[model samples]
Target: MSEIALEARNLYKVFGRNPAQAVKRLKAGETRDDVLDVGTAAVIDASFAVQRGEIFVIMGLSGSGKSTIIRMLNGLHDITDGEVTIGGDPITGIPRGRLREIRRDRVSMVFQHFALLPHRTVADNVAYPLELRGVAKADRRARAEEILAMVGLAGWGDKLPSELSGGMQQRVGIARALAADTDILLMDEAFSALDPLIRREMQEQLVELQAKLQKTIVFITHDLNEAMFLGDRIAVMRDGRIVQIGTPEDILTDPANDYVEQFVQDVDRARVLTAGNVMERPRPYVPDTGGPRAALRQMKDAYSSAAYVTDRDRKLMGIVTDRDAVKLVRKGENSLRSILKPVPQSVSQDETLMNLFVPAVESPLPLAVTDEHDRLVGVIPRVTLLAALGPGPNATEEITLPMPPLPHAEIDAALGGAESAHEASANEVPTIKAPANEGEVR
Candidate 1:
């Protein structure tokens, strides 16, 4: 077994008039007129390699060739040019029987629909693939039961697919794929057909399964949100070309172009950009008894625009700006301490950058992040955040912070939860807003 699970080189898939003409043109040079005159290329010179135990996602709008490239991966659709290597062997030009050997032995695909055997029980549907591959009935059934429990469907093995809800049936389909025990699993928009809440649940379930199984997966989707949530590394496709491929943190904070930026702008960055990504440079020294005035100078020296203030222990205290320091000095105040503003708010290190508004408005001047100990460990100034998440001036939305961790009772008051039970802070694990159009948004 090679360390590399899959590799593709300069793959192209074209359709329409003079398909040969397009293939010939690819050999010489790509011409827009020839492609348009013939047919648009589905995947134009697309290439990448997936190492073992990697979850590689390809996301694009509808008709962006995510599905097409996936089909090519499974040999369901032939590529016009280029080679696809699986397990260190090029399977792109393999014969039908050889391809079947690879599909049955090394790869299995799970479609958006459950594609279950409607007439058979869940156990039978899951075991059918094994049966086709010549596995004995007893072994197939035993494997099916084991996979059933793996996906949380242990006792319902005898139930028909129709008896289960869409999400449950999808779980059955996933269990079936797992029963194959292949080197790679290909998922084609596997969550699209479900309700938003169900889809989100399924996405989380996929993550949990991947953690345990560690199977190399190629997941296809047109939803950027899903790509961000599920992929270990993502490939953003447009008009059949991969625009960018990287970790979700990079895609959210440093998109490649305007198209990528537009998709990121609407996303709640606080929820996507984690605290760890933006904590690049820490201030060199913590201010002594000089108050925030000395701290403001340090802040200005670090970035000249907006800097942070921390306590003697280098824990975030508040922000001291030159303007604030000057005001305190003009008032004949002996110390710049009174001029310092508390952090707008505090946020968990795991939160996405889009959800940053929650803490920004809550904090005073410099944004502080600390563990439950009430010690300031990190700070995010407004300037840094704007440069990270690009959008309209919505970055100005701020929330003030306190010295230490606030109690639940205080948090309830801050959220106005006691005044009206309708609106409260979002749960850390995410509360699924029932299926879309259920009644109201969560």
Candidate 2:
């Protein structure tokens, strides 16, 4: 199956008379203001692809056309001049019967106001979509109960919407959408109406649900922080046009324009940037066979007091200091095992800098970054960590201390020399691979 679950191409939504003519003017050299006499262009030439099981957030201030764009995606609002596809099927110009089928079986929506049927019980409200589809009463009720449990509503399914809190009602709305068993979920400011704490709680619940369900989600919001917290990739809209689309770190570190720069001026960089963003290539190190002589040489050449020891697969064994190396050499010992010190601390590449501050300060050496298999992938030097956390617009700038040679080449040469002297085996260390895009928010 194709990876993309939803797509919008050259989308335009013009409100007013003769919207078609307004689209033509927009395609031409005319600005939005120039076409004001004809119609208001709500969404102008918006284009984006949402991968399956991804959360794609459309964010902007009021009247930026974020909501308008979402409405057009599910055919709730007619597209002035554009196409929308769901699961590789074009839904823009299909017949109303086909569109309704797509809405019922492929797409589900959650609104901001928690549009629950007041008279019906919560379980009945969740089962309403299945009821419309002629599902058996027992089947739909069982499905409703299952979905209610998934969204943390559980036994509250029997209570009326009026008896539940605002947060509970919103959960019911989500439950209703999930009961449709749709591939795509369109949430239009689904949590904006709640109080601050409740909104945060809802956001957390949505993230947890997405982790389990992996639905293709197109979420609309006016809050920047919420967008950053929940969006796998955020499309920032301004004045009816999408200005930039990127991950949270990309938006914070490399904004596309002045508007976006100003828009993200107040964002907390430490929260958005992970260790992967700030870590550099691992420093020169000695192989396990290299011993104290090679370890001392590496520390001298790298102009450092310590050297890391790793196996052929780049799994870190321990660290050896120049002081320890000197003592071992004087004693005529060839192995570094005696003086090796255990790593003080280490962090995974996905750890955020906010959680790294205390460990980074407490570690005696550069912070070690490991992959899933415990192989050292990168290191965050003290200077690099400080620069990343310091106050500045460019939080992603690389800061490195002076070094003698390329890290990999120097280590390779040291290991080669050690193997020849000791008549031991040697192998080239693998470089760190870039992290894959997992369609996750962080």
Number of the predicted model whose TM-score against the real structure is largest: 2
Report lDDT (Cα) of residue 64, candidate 2. Answer: 96
Model 2 lDDT tens row, 297-360: 6665556667678887888999887777767766778888888889877899988888887877
For candidate 1, the lDDT comes to 0.72
TM-scores for every predicted model? 0.70, 0.86
> In candidate 2, how many Å is residue 192 off?
1.5
Give each model's whole-structure lDDT: 0.72, 0.84
Steric clashes per prediction: 36, 0
Give candidate 2's TM-score: 0.86
What lDDT score goes with residue 230 in model 1? 85
- Expressed as tens digits, the lDDT of each residue in 231-329 for candidate 1 is 888998887788888888789867999999887667655556665566433442234355433444343344333335555555556655555555554
Enumerate residue pairs that collide in model 2: none
Q: Ten residues in a row with the worst lDDT in model 1?
A: 433-442
Error of 2 at 404 (Å): 20
